[model samples]
Target: MWAAAKEYFTHPQMESFKRDVINHMRGLWRTWRSKMNCEHVKNHDNLEDILNDVPEFLIKEDWEWLVKEKFLCKEFKKMSKTNEENRALKTMNQHSGRRPVRQIALDLEEKLGRPPTVAELVFKTYKEGDMIKDDAANERHAKILEIMESNPDFTALEVVEAILGEQKRGHVICFGGGLRPKDLKSSTSTKDATDANLEAQLRRSDEEKEALHQSVIELKGTVSEQAEEMATMKAEMKKLQEMFASSQNRQH
Candidate 1:
């Protein structure tokens, strides 16, 4: 399919568009199938009718195997039930709906002017409107923040572990299973670099503040010396006036 479609991408900068599309094709297909299963397949009574309504991209045999051998099997049913229960445990509402969580992360990075920490990204995506849906999500967000603050060098995976009490092998929870450990690592690296730059800027500001404080102290000292000199000059003038007045009285 890509071989035939690649010709339409003629722009020079879009040379890699084919590669990008191919890389994302699996995720897109999974999302599409999940939507179809939830909205139509599970609710419909006639499995034969669904088989007949198979997407054009899928061959008839393949569609039949997926519907009968895969989705309808006992193991798959058990897995689906487990997934539903797990989903029920989640307290935070998904703000993205059908949209991908990865896209939300990209939008956040663009809006924030830097790569957001994992905690920040989780909070933004999990929040419903202006607030989190329940105490569970709020507590998770708070814990993640505390861990990150206490250990600035902790990776995203570590932060998740500290919040959830364990880090599982595949996807990180609250991230919608879109972010993997490697992805989190990459984000952490970028965040660390940004944080380092900010720290450097802070150190420079502190140096400037200290220099200004010292200059203020020196200026106060100079002003005090000038005040003392002025007082001495005033005393000398008064003594001269007294001496002149005494001389004038004696002459009279």
Candidate 2:
């Protein structure tokens, strides 16, 4: 890879070409590592290993000529479809199509105060349809998912807010609860007094309900005890009356 880079850099018009090639190669390396389920590459240390693995045919004079004359200058360049190049290209394509999960997590954490789990993050970030069909959008969605997963508990609105802070694009309209930009702005504009009062009322209502329930239970118990005491008094009075009537009859 160094040799190829040096050779391209030596040519005056090839500086840009060299840079593009390096970028392409680095992208390929990333793809390869992802396929192998390896962690992120920290540096360019294994660049030589990657280059060495590529066949000598790719570096041939004719191939180099084609790269210099055609691919480097094109805005949307097509990679070679040969086996090795295809493998590398496949990884590259996949990498380009998806966003890094860690970045998504960071974004979520910055906005929502917490990250979401993987499933929650995926749902929050991605669209409802097929990912392959919506590559570019899916890539963005994946990035958002990654952010949420890393910072689980971040609200969707928080994620949207963070995104808005970075880019003024009118995209990312709703975060959660179908909140619109105008709604957020309007709500924020309102006085804090209303919110505080509402919260206090809710608390008071809950406390009142609890107190009322306790009072009813106590009253019921008191009523039941009083009824029992009255019944006992009535029985005692009847017994005394019966005794008095019996004594009067005996005297008669």
lDDT of each: 0.67, 0.46
Model 2 C-alpha RMSD vs. true structure (Å) is 30.1
Question: Which ten residues in a row are the worst by lDDT in model 1?
Answer: 8-17
The prediction achieving the highest lDDT against the true structure is 1
Per-residue error at 162 for model 1, in Å? Answer: 0.6
lDDT per residue, candidate 1, 1-252, as tens digits? 466555643333344355445646766876786776786478768978778867677788988888888678898789888988988886544446665555565567679977567677677876788876767777888888888888887766677767775645555654543454555554454376334434443554565566567767878998999999999999999999999999999999
For all predictions, the C-alpha RMSD in Å is 25.9, 30.1
Q: lDDT tens digits, residues 1-252, model 2?
A: 756667533433334344445655887875553443222222224634433333343564544443346434343134322445656542112112254443443455557664443333444355445443457555655665576567554544445454334313322232221123443343321122223323443454565566567767878998999999999999999999999999999999
lDDT, residue 150, model 2: 70
Candidate with maximal TM-score: 1
Clashes by residue pair, model 1: none
